[model samples]
Target: MNEYPIEYYQFFIKFNEGDYYTCHDLLEDMWMEDKSNLFLKGLLQMSVAIYHYSYGNVKGTRLMMKVAHEYLQPYRPKQWGLDLESVIAYIEHCISIIPDDIDKVSFSKIEELPALPTLFLYLEDD
Candidate 1:
């Protein structure tokens, strides 16, 4: 088997540990410098978009998601359909979360979610 660079593991660590932005940033470097892994590249872009969406960065989310879609367009999503759809929903939800009268106060009024929103997703995202 072939090995990828340390940067890949670094990105994975950050992603698994929930340092969303950091993982996203590291993945960008790998995506740009490594030409041998198109699938990995697409996955990383999707991860970045999801990370950005997790932080309410709508534009960043859309940009990366679009890139991911383009890259993966040649393949059949059936293999990773659920994960792919999940990411797409996450990106869209971030955009939808905004409303003309989105009161942060509304969120505050709500009790804690059943699960704390996941900050970092690992191999799945990266």
Candidate 2:
């Protein structure tokens, strides 16, 4: 397998562990090093979205999900051993569960919806 940065792999570890905040922090340095890396940006945004969803921040979740989708779309079927298609579909499903009018909804209401699944990132052997 091709080598990757420790942080890159750690991000997925944190994400799968339901530690989205840590996931975001783990990749911040890498994403900062390459501001133009859409993959990193997308993953960061996705982590933030899940973090917000976990806290029932309706508006934040919705906004972050939208941005993550836009940043990740170009990657399409796959990128860096990650399945972008499945990731995007998961984002779309998350967006669908969130109410359109954030003001009309309460955090408690959001808690009633199905919880977002843990996103496991499996690095493919090249």
Candidate 3:
């Protein structure tokens, strides 16, 4: 199957092409289909994080990045060559430049990554 929705890549292309709102709209559709889909949710959070970062809301951006990290933790996107580490790494890199006086500067760094493990672990119980 295709790795992501047509709209997903379209959003990135639009984002790179400088259409922020369009990106949000695309992700909103995926969000509506399944509120808890980790992939969609994580990407949505990523879009928001980068947007906020660009707008200079360092705190808000960091919060969104943290949420994105939490959302991806369960799946370990690296296994599939997804760019989860780079996402979090970029956010953290930005946060590092923020003065320590910032109130939400609490989360630690992401030092390693590996893709989600096989679900076979649970299947053996059957």
By lDDT, who's the top model here? 2
Tell me which residue pairs clash in candidate 1: 18-120
Candidate numbers, best lDDT first, in rank order: 2, 3, 1
Candidate 3: RMSD to truth: 10.7
* lDDT per residue as tens, model 3, 45-79: 76776565454555776677678767877765352
Candidate 1 wrongly placed segments (more than 4 Å): 35-38, 73-126
Per-residue lDDT for 37-88 in model 1, tens only? 5555666776776555454454665566667666655543422222445444
TM-score of 3: 0.63
- Provide the TM-score for each candidate, comma-separated: 0.50, 0.89, 0.63
Quantify all predictions' global Cα lDDT against the true fold: 0.54, 0.83, 0.57
* Residue 83 Cα positional deviation in candidate 1, in Å, after optimal superposition: 9.4
For every model shown, the clashing-pair count is: 1, 0, 1
lDDT at 1 for candidate 2? 71
CA-only RMSD, every prediction: 6.4, 1.9, 10.7
Clashing pairs in 3: 79-115
Model 2 TM-score, all chains together = 0.89
Q: Whole-model lDDT, candidate 3?
A: 0.57
Of models 1 and 3, which has the larger TM-score? 3
lDDT of 2: 0.83
Query: What is the per-residue lDDT of model 2 for residues 1-126, given as tens digits with 9 covering 90 to 100?
Result: 778889999987788888899989987889999999998999999999888877677788889999999999998888888888889998998888777766234566766756776567777764
